[model samples]
Target: MKPLLSIWIMLLCGIAGRSFAQTKTSTDTVVKPPVQLKTVHIVQYNFFKDSLAFREEYAKSLTFRRLKWYEVYGGLSVNINNLYRVTQFKKNKKKITFKHMLLNKEQEMFVSRVYTPSLVNKVTHLDGDSLQLFMQHYQPDYAFIKNASDYDLYLAIKKEYEAFMKTRDSIPVQP
Candidate 1:
């Protein structure tokens, strides 16, 4: 390559590197909520969030090696389409495996009303059972998501808007 071109390339590389390093250090980072709720307080909170986003567009192809959130639980932000055809759930603890056709989708759960003072110690809640539950419930779904995408696998997250309507009469809400 010409010397002038090479010099210009070096200058551009240096500028790009410096700008990237500075931007990364200065960017604002958003923090997520600490996980672990024995019973979802406002059961509708997460259910509502996902219900709003369930239907953007399903990608026809998937590149994941495992299932995602949509496979086990339905939520608004998850894509649902082709996944219903081949989704499977393997419960390692119980030594039970479930396929889409085998899962008993007819689940009946009442929202457990928790009565706790807001100022109670946070320390008691952080322990083994909560961690296990967290792993049992959330880790696998994320594991699935980490491996898969819209390209091949397809599944729909339960839309939030309708979820409330479907369960509104069933679970009494606190005003």
Candidate 2:
């Protein structure tokens, strides 16, 4: 009976010692706080600034490209044709091509206005080469930006940046 009591006491002491050691090790470990991304307050889109930029681009294109009189006439015709549908004018490939060029320019301007570098930087907190890379990789389409509100654009950028960071973190480093 004395031997059995001694063995039981020894077992209890061993278990207690292990639990005490575990508690000490746990207390020694430092807990790190989770990382939080920065937030941006977006302002409303400025139509006045957008119009001025469009005018500047138009003038630059006209001056540098030295577009012919016929081309200008064709572009104007296409605009008029849109208001009052003319089947014959629509069939004209040259006029259609000129109109397409103007539309492309306008789309490019719209995208730039909506997705400005400053806006992206504000949302993503990225700059220099990283900023440039993000902009290049996640450039929004004109259709998407055209309908998106400032807040929508901001959320889209934030989501993209999070995904970008996740992928970047997952990539293994090589020596």
Candidate 3:
């Protein structure tokens, strides 16, 4: 019985040693390359042209996007400032400026579309410096253009052209 017990203990020790040796040899034989980390580039939305929906989406992504220390500081400062009335006024001013810029651009586009050089030329039969002079002098305001129909605009241009022709010689031609 003592011999049998000794044999069982030796067998268990041998099995454990073999398993440990096998694991060690397996780990030693396998070669792993050093991990190479790739640089990640994050792109933020354009502030000028971004729509409200896009702004909302971008704000939602703030949690995942990694920002620099200064960027984080600046953002927090701006957000905190937004809670106060004085800082809010500054934001409102910026918005007003942006709105005015957009309105001005729209007005310019409307003027270009309705009071085109071609339309003026066709109406006046004038060319070169005189045509340019007439258009500049009689350039309709945004409000007038907005309120006037196509026919009204055409008649107005024709009438203005006639008036311009009468005083054509009187107006000084810029060199």
Candidate 4:
């Protein structure tokens, strides 16, 4: 009986020691995702609402598709400003910055409520004909071509258009 008891204790100690030794070393390595894997492109709508509304409401109001979510809810914006070093959309954690998103009249009005009156005047006054004329005649300067805001681009084209009109008016009429 004593011999049997000693054999059982030795067997139990051997099994415990083996289990402890196996756990001391880990072979697994930590893997990290690539930078590109985190970013996703989405065709966000050009919608802005001051109050909290359903996402369905935003979807309904969508006039055009853009590559980003615009500032709509002030609380969300404030929370973003407080929590994140960079303001990102609630849905995705991508960096938020201005992109050259075209705005229809309604969208323009929504944005212009926060923007300057001069910008509203400049943007609202330019019709399709003016846009076509500007595009046809205006060659923006190299400096103006790069990293220009929509407002800056419009102002540059409008200035060029006005210059072209002045030149055209000065040309003498052939009898």
Candidate 5:
């Protein structure tokens, strides 16, 4: 029984010694190359000034490992946090809101107006208040231009010309 126990202990020691020797040779013979880090630029645009800016320290060189989903999510979160830093916000210690951060009065007004393609087309056509004053002086020229042979168009032009002349006549003449 004593000899058998002694043999078991000798086998365990031999296995442990072989493992240590293998680890040492593997570590010594295999040289790990120095890590090559790449630099990344973090850019942010200032909407009010219409300019872009970047930080030297924040855009430092980095070493990237495998691209994991969680790491990608974390990177996006960091980018959002950096973006928020550039914007102006009104906040107390208890609460914060981002409504006023990247917006000005003019931009807010523009955003408030829901501009559709039809509205843009109408604006391009010179309709509404803009054309009201012009229309008072001259009937829309397009009606006469497109249908030059029509007697009604000719009458309309004649009427507009007379009205414009009458308004001119009404103005007091400077001698």
Candidate 6:
């Protein structure tokens, strides 16, 4: 029984050590993703409800496809202040910060809401067009592109915007 218990303890510690070791980013070898990941940020005034609704729908829309999607929900222009600092979305954690400006005092108050997803799946239900639109448009005015053989992220953005605007009848697909 003592030998069996010792083996179990050793196995648990081995798992724990491996988990901690995996968090390090490897600089020597770089793994590039085949398809580019995209996100869009749109701003609006006097349409707080609409913006919130769109945020929720955006999340659902993103989940439509078999890829990871991200949506930000907030009131009016408030979310912009905090979400901007997020350089990258950490795996399963959703961090939300709320701030309110007080008219009487010269200080801003801060409140944060942190949620860990019960179950996180990087896949969802959006169509190809919508998915394309979501990734391409960083702002309503900004689009990002994935480079081809000459793959330039910026050029991809430019091409996608032009392609999105032109009519299919204007130019037919060339075989």
- Compare the candidates by lDDT and give the number of the best one: 2
Q: How many backbone clashes does candidate 6 have?
A: 12
List the candidates ranked by lDDT, beginning with the highest.
2, 3, 4, 5, 6, 1
Candidate with best TM-score: 3
- TM-scores of the candidates in the order shown: 0.18, 0.45, 0.47, 0.22, 0.19, 0.15
Candidates arranged by TM-score, highest first: 3, 2, 4, 5, 1, 6
Instruction: Please provide, for model 1 over 3-121, each residue's C-alpha lDDT reduced to its tens digit, 9 standing for 90 to 100.
Output: 99999999999999999888885347768799996975565445333423322221111112355545644565545553653454443212232222122221111011111112111
Across 1-175, the per-residue lDDT of candidate 3 in tens digits comes to 9999999999999999999887785447767798999989998743344444444554433223223334424543654432353435565566566656655765676677678788888877888888889987888999999899888998999889888889988988765
Candidates' lDDT values, in order?
A: 0.37, 0.74, 0.71, 0.49, 0.44, 0.38
Q: What's the residue-level lDDT of 125 in candidate 5? A: 44
Q: Tens digits of per-residue lDDT for model 4 on 137-166?
A: 454443444457787767765676567667
Give the 10-residue window scoring lowest on summed lDDT in candidate 1: 106-115
Residue pairs with backbone atoms closer than 3 Å in model 4 (clashes): none
TM-score, predicted candidate 6 vs. hidden true structure = 0.15
Off by over 4 Å in 6: 26-175
Candidate 6 lDDT over residue span 50-123, tens digit each: 44554475554333322222333354444553444443444223322111112111111100011001100112
lDDT of 2 by residue, 65-91 (tens): 322334434543545533334334544
Q: Which consecutive 10 residues in model 4 have the weakest lDDT in total?
A: 94-103
Off by over 4 Å in 5: 1-10, 22-27, 44-175
Comparison by TM-score, 1 against 4, better one? 4
If candidate 1 were superposed on the true structure by all CA atoms, what would the RMSD be? Answer: 24.5
lDDT of 2: 0.74
The runs of at least 3 residues in candidate 4 whose Cα sits more than 4 Å from the true structure, single-residue gaps closed, are: 1-121, 141-143, 147-155, 167-175
Count of steric clashes across candidates, in order = 20, 0, 0, 0, 0, 12
lDDT value for model 6: 0.38
lDDT of 3 at 13: 100
